[model samples]
Target chain A: MILKKLFSRRKEEYWWMTIAVPLVAILLALITGVIFIKATGRSPLKAYKLLFGSSGLFPSPYWKNHFAEMLLSSSMFISTGLAFSIAFKGGLFSIGAEGQFIVGGIVAAYFGYAEPFAGLPTILHLIIIFIMAMAAGGIWGAIAGWLKTKKGIHEVITTIMLNWIALYLIEDWLVTGPMKANISTGISGTPYISATAKLPNILPGTRLNISFIIIAAAVFFTWFLLYRTTIGFEIRAMGYTLVFGMEAPKASGVNVNRRIIQTMFISGAVASLGGSFIVLGILFQYPPVFEGGYGFDGIAVALIGQNEPVGIFLAGILIGALRTGATSVQLAHIPKTFPSIIEGLIVAFIALQELIRYLIMKLIVPKRSKSD
Target chain B: MDNTSLLNSSLTQTMDYAAPILFAALGGVMSENAGVFNIALEGIMRFAAFFGVWGAYISGTPWIGLLWGIGIGIVIGSLHAYITVKWAGDQIVSGVAINVMSMGIITYLLELIFKTTGYSPPVPYFGSSVNRIHIVFIENIPFLGAFSNLTILVWFAIILTVLMHFMLYRTVFGLRIRSVGENPYAAETLGINVVRIKWFAVIMGSIFAAFGGMALSLGTLSSFTNAMANGKGFIGLAAMIFGKWTPFGAMAASLLFASAQVIQLLLQVAASGFAKLIPLGFYLALPYILTIGALIGVVGRAVPPAADGEPYKKE
Candidate 1:
């Protein structure tokens, strides 16, 4: 009864809850890593170093390559993270970023090698491909949004089903049939993209390309649109009120269906750009088994960052750095999957924030509130 | 072969594929009936697939593997129940966490135990011919021959479907679960133990999902691959929705979805010219496409339990 009374007082819960969520997440992740690191017969200190060495925090000899890898991978994460964050802000859990990314990659890769675009100026060719990829991706994302808005089908089911469709469409149909490269070797992929369509490498001897610059601009654009604009306000409002069933809340300045579609469009375009970077910057062509991992991981990045633009950028870097570091840790005889465990634990802790708040409230508020 | 034999082969294959999906759809039905939205069915199946293999590998007994699968299901189910029921956690977030963790954890465990990355070596399995239940009378029957040489796991799946149908529609416990799902406060007022009921439903649901995973590894194949249970769990979820969350309905849905695979295989075997006319990807994507179509067709018509996915707290 005392616990129930303490819990009923909402103000007390938020006081410690704000401080505890992030603190507990980090602590729990650290404990998990330490336990697994110990299981591998390694000291936690060295294991952390090896695991984080890819972030270039330590002045190791191969730090340059490691750091560059972290930055390059982070560009993809940040872009996809932005994709998830935007839709999330619009009160939609759209996991179609995976499919959107593939759509963009397929478009970008195709246009990069298309015959009609041959001998065009580098900038013009790149511009055409970029626009095409974004359009393709936007359409892909909008399909789920359209289904949700018009057909009343849930976005989660549609997005997951779309993901599988995209996977098979690319792998089993397109790559194997129409778009299969005209090469005799066993390699299953499209033809190499022309150098003119590629994103120029920014750092010397590193894979870090102008993709990072593009993603940085995207981050700013997302922040500006979300925080400063009227459209963004309506989107955020829609999230809070979730007035999708209503035709249009004109008084509240929100068109629910239109906002849903627009949010998904922007989210898909951003995620598609992330995938295009792989084609234009790294792969230079779509691989047959371009089965995406980063796209799905974007959900984690978005949630971990709490769906904020800057938070996504930071979380992207953290996850990208860990992914890069996992290989080095694997060489040290530790399970590379340890990072995933930490990622899962972090999300789990965040999901259980309410329970954490209740426990913290019980500890800190019960005695003080007893007088009431 | 001849037409009857061809039809029989397709029927048998359909049954093989449908069993796993049926098991998972049944799991979803049970949990959702008690007001828990358990998307972690996929993750539970993945974890169970690996543990089933590990258990069998260590003990040289498939029974131990089945036990292992059930044990892990109970443990993961409790974790999910604790988060969603006890703490009022976001169901989607918790489900995503379990899935992501399962992907990495299973891969790591596979390497640690088997010293292989892609798949485990073949072990004692239920799918092996000697372990199959041979119904002598049905052995020579044409279409019925499909059920003649079936594994114990497949029989369990078919039996459980009927059991679940009866359990959900005919029993008082089923009514209580449905009532709790519909209105937890009302059920509480009627002296029903909502928490305990939710816990039981979730755990049983997870065990059913684990059975699906076992069907993937131990029932269909003698080995556990990293890709075991692939998108089958999600497909099962689709079946659950398409079936409108009933056991017999889910069974019909699973069979319908699984028939796509059967048709694809049959098409390949029948005429090379015709099979080549259609892209292989179409066959592969048929079930998913059907899923979306089915969902779109049924939207707003098939309603869920009134209080489904809502956290119930005492006033």
Candidate 2:
């Protein structure tokens, strides 16, 4: 009877469950990570301490620069996380954020170095580059959307393929051929962007730049777009077809295909902004090799944030801290990839949330209520 | 070398490249045909590659290493099956999680065991145990000469392709798997053990994927490298789709992709001037571009199983 009751479905109207489940999942993941660390003959507590210390949570003078690094990293995550969140909310999976990011960065880099753009006013140059980057990313994303609408191809497959295409195209052709800088020395990557296009540093002696403000504005814009607009309502309706019924949207004459394309365009544009920030604010040029799985990391952030803009911002910061702290763990003779394992574990645990919810319900709801 | 010899060498290289992809694609066919989207093939293959090398290094036998790889594949497969089938979890999310976990765990193990992260030490080769057979007259043939010096895994992949074709099309068990995939409710109503069949198919597919990983690490390099699987599993998934989810069709697709890869390599080597004239990126991106084109071409007509990606619920 208890087993049957446990398996039975119950209404999940309580909002606390949403907050509690991810927290519990995170806790479980950390415990699992600790076990893995212990198995490696390392003190989990020390490793974690170092991780947080380097993340700038601790007021350690030795790791003074850690906070700046964490903020810088989180900026990219916040943008990409918003990118993923936007698409996910529209019921489209935009796995090509990685590709969009690359193209965005490369396009911005190209325009930043263009001779004509070099002489423009600083604000105009930055605006033009950002717009071009968004357009490039939007075009890339729109291709996947077009395929889904016209060809019935899954975005996941197309996006995955596009990522490799973007990587190879940049690495082999652009970086090695037309974009190659310092050709006499055979160095890879393009020339540095004009100083006018560069994002001004917000803090002296730190990498933090105006990109943080831009990202914060983007987050607010996304929230406004998703919640305070008619289009957003239609998109949400199309997304929650299971809840609202697919017929209602069709009956109301909301063009589903156009919505898919629009969502993907916005998704790609946001992700491209992340790439643009990386180039203008940090690298000042498109590098031959781009490290960090910003696109995939966005998926985790979006999921943990439950597709909320503010939530994604917080999740991005959390991930950024973990990534920054992981370097310290690496210095302590532990692999830097340990934080990724914890992230993966959290996702896995989240996947099992339904089971967890059932168990929780069983524990909390009285057995006497079985008659009801 | 003459043009014919060059062509022959390229064909041989294509076969070498195709073998691992063919194995993995066939695995994809098995799982997808049974209604499970095995997105964790990449992670499974990576884990197997590591274990294949580790087992050979420890046991001093390549065969044992192969077994170890398969064993690990089964474990991962069962976990995936349990999570998706029993728990009704999101397949893509779970698959991504597995991939992420595999990356971390494998890198951790690599550092812990070998004290290095780039590559593992070379392991024993299967060639030492099994002698190569030479058919001299046939080896002289122009294109066929490519088969002259090849690993046993290449032959295994080809033979398995044919065998899988028959097994999937002609077997009772295969019918049941298909039935479950197409309509689990109907299959269950007809007394078929849907969950059990799915578990079996997933496990079998994972084993095949592991062998593909082994072919990469053991068949060629005899060592494990980080990210050595290098999106071959995704390519295999692509091949599976391009093939319309058939064993023979997947083999043909794998061969086509392999040819594209070989042509790219040839461009880099034999025609450096031309390679430079046309950006190297175009060549590198050719196979994926072709796969995407193929997907676009076939999406409407090439229908997947009706129940594919849906979690089966028993009422």
Superposed on the true chain A, the predicted chain A of model 2 yields a TM-score of 0.89
Q: Alpha carbon lDDT of residue B240, candidate 2?
A: 78
Q: Which ten contiguous residues of candidate 2 chain A have the minimum total lDDT?
A: A2-11
**What does candidate 2 score on TM?**
0.90
Worst 10 residues of 2 chain B by lDDT: B126-135
Indicate the fraction of true inter-chain contacts that candidate 2 also forms: 0.57
Q: Please, what are the lDDT tens digits per residue for candidate 1 over residues B1-315?
A: 776666776788899999988998999999998988878778889988888988998999899999999999998888888888888887767777787788777887777778888799888899898898888787657999888888898899999999988888899998999998989999999999999999899899999999999999999988889887787887788778667788988898899878877776666656466667888788778777887786667546456677777776766
Docking class of 1: medium
DockQ, candidate 2, vs. native dimer: 0.61
Report the lDDT tens digits of candidate 1 across residue range A81-193: 89988998887878788889988998999999888895889889999999999999998899989988898777777787888888888888887888889877555688888
DockQ of each: 0.61, 0.61
Candidate 2: segments with Cα more than 4 A from true spot: A1-11, A57-64, A183-188, A227-230, A233-252, A365-372, B126-137, B270-276, B294-301
For candidate 2, give the docking quality class from DockQ. medium
- Scored on chain A only, each candidate's TM-score is 0.87, 0.89
For model 1, the superposed segments whose C-alpha errors exceed 4 Å read A1-20, A40-43, A57-59, A184-187, A241-255, A358-372, B271-275, B294-300
Q: Which ten residues in a row have the lowest lDDT in candidate 1 chain B?
A: B295-304
